[model samples]
Target: MTRTESLANRLQEVLLNGRWIANTNYKHQLEDITWEQAIKKVGSLNTIAALTYHVNYYLAGILNVFRGGELEIRDRYSFDLPPICSKEDWDNLVDEFLTNSEAFVLEVSKLPDHKLDMPFVDEKYGTYLRNLEGVIEHCYYHLGQISFLKKLIFA
Candidate 1:
């Protein structure tokens, strides 16, 4: 399959996909939560909304890098969306993050096999793949954290 398709599959299957995984110890699989509930605290007071925003922000930054722009590592899990946070904000940063990630993946998939060998200095982590593959890897990494956080928050 194409590289972009693979990346898209990863995103849909995990990060932005619906339907949580049942029979799993991970609380991330806990489904049917609204934004309010996501940010609600039952015991530990962990907000899925916060995790979602952080993941989306990081993904957006990486995608921007792939599109030949600067990669800016934004905030982590917090109350605000970091760098840009407002009720009047775009209100679609998460969606935009996913969209931009997929677009970046598409561009990378079309690259010639040799192009992946090129070198680009990473802003956050220097000396990396300098390709879309790196971006995909980074997204999945954060996704794992989001999932794990869900477990802790729910547990």
Candidate 2:
């Protein structure tokens, strides 16, 4: 398979799910964590809630730009960290996160091969691959943090 195809497939496996491996994904370190447990921040890192928001931020940010949505920072608030004091709120945010993630994956899958080589510059990351793989990497980076925070809050 082509590099983009491989990345797209794996990204679907990891990010399309409604939630991360919290104790349920056997190989995932944070398995078994309750959603409530996912929202608490026991240390220096952002709570799973915040990390999830950041993931959504990049997902929406990239997808939006691909769809002719502007790259202005002010317009990127949909993915910013939100307060996660209650289970319902956390559930809602998580759902939104999943929805955006799925949308991003689908969007990236449709990108033309040439478009992948294009350059995109913004305040967030100065230069980036203008395609699906970059989006997938951004998602994985934040997911790593979310999974790590899950361990702290739960295990």
* lDDT digits (tens) for residues 17-86 of candidate 1: 5343322211233243444445555556435566566556655666666677885565443235543334
| Candidate 1 TM-score, C-alpha based | 0.55
Candidate 2 stretches with Cα past 4 Å from truth are 1-3, 17-35, 74-80, 121-132
**Model 2 weakest lDDT span, ten residues long:** 21-30
Backbone clash pairs for candidate 1 read: none
lDDT of 2 at 130: 40
Score each candidate by Cα lDDT.
Answer: 0.50, 0.60
Q: Which ten residues in a row are the worst by lDDT in model 1?
A: 21-30
Cand. 2 Cα-lDDT: 0.60
Clashing pairs in 2: 22-31, 22-32, 23-30, 23-31, 23-32, 24-32
Candidate 2 lDDT at 23 equals: 24
Candidate 2 lDDT by residue in tens digits, 1-155: 65555555666766754333322221232234456776665756666666666666766667778788777544347446656677677677667766776676676667665555656645455333444555556656666776667656655
Candidate 1 segments exceeding 4 Å error: 1-13, 16-31, 42-46, 74-91, 122-138, 141-155
